[model samples]
Target: MSAGGRGGVRATLSGLTTRGRSFLAAGIAAAVCAYVLGQDDLLRVGLLLAALPLLCAAVLHRTRHRVTAERGLAPARVPATGEARVRLRVDNVSRLPTGLLMLQDRVPYVLGPRPRFVLDRVEPGGHREVSYRVRSDLRGRYRLGPLQVRLSDPFGMCELTRSFSAYDTLTVLPRVEPLPPVRFGGEALGHGDGRQRSLALAGEDDVIPRGYRHGDDLRRVHWRSTAKHGELMVRREEQPRRSRCTVLLDTRAAAYEGAGPGSAFEWAVSGAASVVAHLLERGFSVRLLTDFGVTVSGEGGSGHERAAAAALMMDTLAVIDHSDGADLAGAYDVLRDGHDGLLVAFLGDLDGGQAASVARMRRRGGAVAFVLDPDAWTREPTAVPEPNAPLPQRLRVLREGGWTALGVPRGASLEELWRQADRERPGPAALSGKARG
Candidate 1:
């Protein structure tokens, strides 16, 4: 509602307390019996009973006491399944003291149970603070609330409810598990070499002009840079590149199987988040992108800024949804554009065409693959595997294509897989380059 005052007398009267309603009901019955029995005493009692609640209602409706609420969330951004505290402060601004306050906060069921608080009383011109903890397993942004409080009259015959308009948002980031760090064969180059390679990927606006050569094309001359340098300068046809590590996640609905948190898709997202965090902490410039080409990039930083960037990345990963793309064509182009960088991909099931498309990106840079094991995915979550074959052929396909690939089980720990990856040697083509195979 716009304001408590907006609820007119009719609305206010509708808030008649349970006691009030019962008393009124009893009074009506008594009056009816009195009429049939012709009893004057009963009639007089009935009149008094019926009048009391009405009088209380009228008294409550006339109250001009004003209430205001302020809400706050501590550590508003939390990881999935993490807890956050919500503090709500309510004030009585009117001249009259409040009778009682029954406070309840509105929240979604996913965020756990609603919190209710009881305050004995609040003096006029005074305020009280109450707090509750909320936890959610799901990742997304959730609103905490406009606080609603029930105010009662002294006799308890009537009560009114008022709601504060203020709302607070809590961001639940995807769970980013810490992973052990390991050197990658295609992860980095000599600092100078990497920088030079990065320039080749620069955008037009990032053009760094150089002294014009004898064979330089006139069309390539950078007019602005020439004026600034006071000499003929030609645009360096280098592709601008700063991203050192790219984490590609397959969001195509067809690529993944199952639903919910225990599914391969969710496991992949969580693992991707972990890998992104590990890279950021290691001072690597990172980029996270979906197969559909949606991307989020963060500059390399080790302090407060790193935390902020991680939050940004986590926020994006938290809300990412499955895509409708049938193939990895969008991602293929993205992966094939970088050089002297590390490309880490978390993919679902891959057919021959998809695997071939993914493999072709290896020539542009080193690649690491996390593929879901079809055998594990086809089984129930509670089913135990009997050490049977787990799609060795698919993993072999990616390995032969020069990727350091590992098969991920539906409910397996990513940290364990990271250890396994570090123990294994990369393909010969990994340290150098890969031709389409």
Candidate 2:
């Protein structure tokens, strides 16, 4: 027999039910006894028994049918604790009808359980679709796929399994909080690193359109221009001086207290995500800077561009991990040359030098910093602090350098802190004023 034929036979035999195996074993014993005793009736019985299992195997091998599976993830992207649906479709394309089919799609433990489904039978050219819901409490890009389909005979004598190689991805983003609008202040933020700029109006000349780019929003299409030009055309994008904001996150493993998902590092990450979402919503072009480097950025003042950029930002944050670097110099480097309109950072513990660097990192624009308190996040709870103690001396340095710095203690509300930073003021006061405990 050919290799394929031999493999088919092996697969056929491997699918044998216990009862089929027992019948085959009994048939072999009966045939041996008959030969020894020279009994015709026993020999006939042995031949009949031996043929039964062989017939079943032949039936299973002869009618090989192909099944196909397709998986779909609804909303493909979701935030932590947000739910999404998964739809699965199976089709039987062969000429012959298929027996019972058991379907199971693999999923990550964080998403809950693996969903299993069953089909009574599939006629020739038949199809079936099933769906399940999955949700996760932590952020990450996870795979849910390679549908496993088990084909079984009605008599339970044989079974075969086929798995689809295709897989679908589901991205779970960090917990994003809807922040209240907050106005900030600093020196006149001259457009330094603007991504979008409005075209200077010269009456009718300014209305002249350009060919649509790949990321251009269809809403901006100028049909009149397209008809005149005999090709697709869109309004000229704004000038490259739109307001910009940089959301920095401290990801150094040694900077935060404790470990795992509950560490101060994770808290900083989530807070940074919230700030990014808020800035984009407020029509500011936003970029995510980390201790490691730039994670992602969103450009343009238009809704379409911001939406696409936001998606990319969240996807990047979903899989972000801690950095081994001991310093937050990456953030400084990313902002060194650019004068961002706003600098919002979620930082972990900082010594005097790093704190000074962070303070000078933003050359111009409104700067807000949330410094995580390492004492509160220690693996073991330490002694409680006095009710009216002042914050760390680094924060004073930050205040002197014109950064709106606040200490993030355990159970602190980010929204409240954001509101506090919104008020613009200089040192020696709480909230909008100088450094306070």
lDDT of 1 at 204: 61
lDDT of 1 by residue, 52-142 (tens): 8888777566543477777889989999889999988878777777777789999888898899998877788898999999998878888
lDDT values for all models: 0.78, 0.76
Deviation from truth (RMSD, Å), model 2: 5.9
Reference-based TM-score of each model: 0.78, 0.81
Clashes of 1: 6
lDDT of 2: 0.76
Q: Which tens-of-lDDT digit does each residue in 156-222 have in candidate 2?
A: 6677666667888999899887788766642223234434444646554467688988988999898
